[model samples]
Target: MGKAKYLSAVEQGMVVGARRTGLSVSRTATLLCFSCSTFYQELPHKLTEQDRQLLKCVLHKNHLSSVTTLTTEYQTASGSNVSTKTVRRELHEMGFHGRAATHKTKITMHCPNSLLEW
Candidate 1:
């Protein structure tokens, strides 16, 4: 069965506590609505503290930075290859939403202060 939700530390602890209390794996899994394999699975986080620091620094210096640019900078700073999608995902997780320029200027706008030509 698919995961009902991502298992946080609290959820893992609950599973462990349940197991210690003589609850069977299937019973615990049923109670939590998690698959039996979920208790045995451990997923590592993609970004490190250093990577987060670098991302914060880069974003602070340039608010308009694109995901591609962020990925490039992260790769350069951390010496690790990362995809733009990963960078975009991390940005979203950190609450940075995509920004698009919406303001448009007139095509033919004359200068307010113009000198008379002979």
Candidate 2:
């Protein structure tokens, strides 16, 4: 219900460097343009146990294609509502990206020259 707790990569690196330079948590947070309390609150990622289990299920399943489909399947199986944006953002955080799938390639490529090189 609070503002989403997100720090950019630069901010995260700066936070680490601030600690290394012996900046107090309060000063460091101030330098980063946010309150010390917010810094502490946002510092540790609080992935709930339920979210972890659901995310694990999502990552391990190959049948899933898009976040739209993923959210639908998750809601059906878990009886809960999770947004496509939440799934998409979390997927990005979890090191997964979405790209349009092209049907140009078959299961096997017919490049004999490339196959011979392999």
Candidate 3:
């Protein structure tokens, strides 16, 4: 058989189209850079069951959960020590992060009438 052409443009177009119309995987893969076989072979890494449960627990309990807290809790509960770095990696994997700053102006102007009321 002859060498097959890479359909990167078609794949990209399909991905964009999928975003618009939500096409099936086979159709999307047919349009991609690699063949459907390659796409199926290189499926993304998904979280294991144990990790998913642990993440659910961590997220459910804490308001200000951080990597340090999660790692410590995981080690204490499961007797398996995971590094802060590892916890951070896991948090990133699960799409969690510490809160970002609120950009509110701090300065306040007070009127003499307001002061008199106080």
- Stretches of candidate 1 off by over 4 Å are 1-43, 101-118
lDDT, each prediction = 0.78, 0.73, 0.65
The lDDT leader among the candidates is: 1
Screening candidate 2 with a backbone cut-off below 3 angstroms (N, C-alpha, C), the clashing residue pairs are none
**Better structure of 1 and 2 per TM-score:** 1
Instruction: Please state every model's RMSD to the true fold in angstroms.
Output: 10.5, 12.7, 12.4
Q: Estimate each model's TM-score.
A: 0.49, 0.42, 0.46
Query: Model 3, 2-110: lDDT tens per residue?
Result: 5555445556565657646886667776555345664544444344569657765876687477667777787777677667776676676677777778999889877
Best by TM-score: 1
Error of 3 at 38 (Å): 15
Summarize candidate 2's per-residue lDDT along 1-118 as a digit string, tens digits: 6776677788888898998999999889888887776666556543455875787597679445767888777677777677877767667777778667877846775687867897
Model 1, range 37-115, lDDT digits (tens) per residue? 7765643447887887788787777777777887787788779887887777777878889868899976985655645
**Ranking of all predicted structures according to lDDT, beginning with the best and ending with the worst:** 1, 2, 3
Question: lDDT value for candidate 3?
Answer: 0.65
